[model samples]
Target: TLSLFYCMVGVVLVTGGSGLVGNGIREALGKHETGEEYDWVFLSSSDCDLRDKQAAVELFERMQPKFVIHCAASVGGLFKNMKNKLTMYQDNMDINRNVLAACHHMKVQKLVSVLTTCIFPDSIEYPFESSQLHDGAPHPSNEGYAYAKRMLEVESRLYREQFGHNFVCAVPSNIYGKYDNFHLEDGHVVPCLIYQAYLAKKSGQTLKVLGSGAPLRQFVYSIDVGLLLIWMLFNYNDEEPLILTSNEEISIGDLAQLIVNAWGGNIEIQTFILPTAFNLKYNAVRFQQS
Candidate 1:
């Protein structure tokens, strides 16, 4: 039996604390009213490599947190996901396993882990529900990462069923904000486009965007997701995972134009299989004139 004393006031540990979502949670908690109720320990990969079982156990023992918010995962953009599918799957699976196991062993009061909208099936109906997660296979482009995340949800439910643990999952759509990865080849759409557009302006070139600009996507700012997480921590206690999204869909072309407007530029759009290095000096001159 778990001791009542330890449960009364315990540390709150957030894994993957350096990334976008993790940083967002930290920012939100700093401004929250009840934030100071417990000691908050944010663990980045530098603090502890959670892929190792022993490291996870030792860190959990050292922190002795009664509550855990698991945000750690191997994440990447489209190119990286497609190129390194095996790495994505194995690394994330190990990390989720080690952390959730540690939390269970330590008898943590509650654990909130994050899931992404990409885990949904490729052929599912519109307006996604939690129940439709496993109805069909995910899109082929990122199936390895998607299936790995799906299993994490499965683990959460299994733990709840067998042990009656309060481990829960939070699913959010295409999160973007400050501290997001901005890699030219491996970053998400928003940051990648922003960085590319900046470069285009700087180098006197046209910004090269990949694929047809017709794909619709819904994006949630990391800070807003963070606030919702806080609310979930305090108010939500359930087996069903909560989907955190704004439900606003914008096409890639419109999104690109929005980015251009945000950056004070009007660039021409060209569709290509691979992003072409369009070194058009005229485009840069036009951008400058505008």
Candidate 2:
């Protein structure tokens, strides 16, 4: 029986188990001594299609998780977001809606959903605050994905108010680390640059970077975010979504130089200015550690 399987402790399920964030969570858990307290299950997309409500519910029933960390979403780089807005929006909305519904149906004790800083308004003030999430529209390049994520936060709050579910959301700035998507065109900035540098190093050619590389953005290590998430799972009980980010802000140009320097070999950096439509300047996220 489900209860029999977890006689000693309850199950804590993490979706997107094979992704970058999922691997971070796994690494964090490995460093801790929580194995005796909870059974951790990491699930990948191959396990089930979360966009399908029935499949999501069945997976929940099978896992019988007492807690859930929702990290699954249709995500990509700036160009991908711009080109495939509809697909991004639809897929994320479906995945989020189904997962939340299944979690509610199964009476999961607590659910922490992962969100990105990109969901904030495009023209908002620096030091993004959670309270200003919906004050204005997000950047046009990623509006579809941004709006979908905004709805996830909305649904989380609605579920909490109507059903008293302990559904929380974590908003993190640009996340980069091991196991990240390294696709040059479709991956996030850091991994994309890393991959580009690798290719440049192999070919001994100048590394080409997109845009002016002048956008200032905050980046947080996935492992650190993972550690904080585990802490939130046990201690945070409020409805307000928490912003998890580092204080340091680095321009893309400087970041690229850093990546090239880390490669050690002499590799020239060349910036390819993309259209204005592709330019996105992210301000540093302000987070006060408690």
Highest TM-score model number: 2
List, residue by residue over 52-147, the lDDT tens digit for candidate 2. 999999989888889999999988998899999999999999999999999999999999999987788877666656888899988888888999
CA shift of 275, model 1, Å: 13
Output the number of the lDDT-best candidate: 2
lDDT of residue 33 for candidate 1? 67
Task: Provide C-alpha RMSD values for all models, in order.
Answer: 8.6, 2.4
Q: In candidate 1, which residue ranges exceed 4 Å CA deviation? A: 1-9, 273-290
State each candidate's clash count: 0, 0
Candidate 2 has its poorest 10 consecutive residues by lDDT at 276-285
Instruction: Write down the RMSD of candidate 2 (Cα, Å).
Output: 2.4
lDDT of each model, Cα atoms only? Answer: 0.81, 0.85
Q: What TM-score should be assigned to candidate 1?
A: 0.90
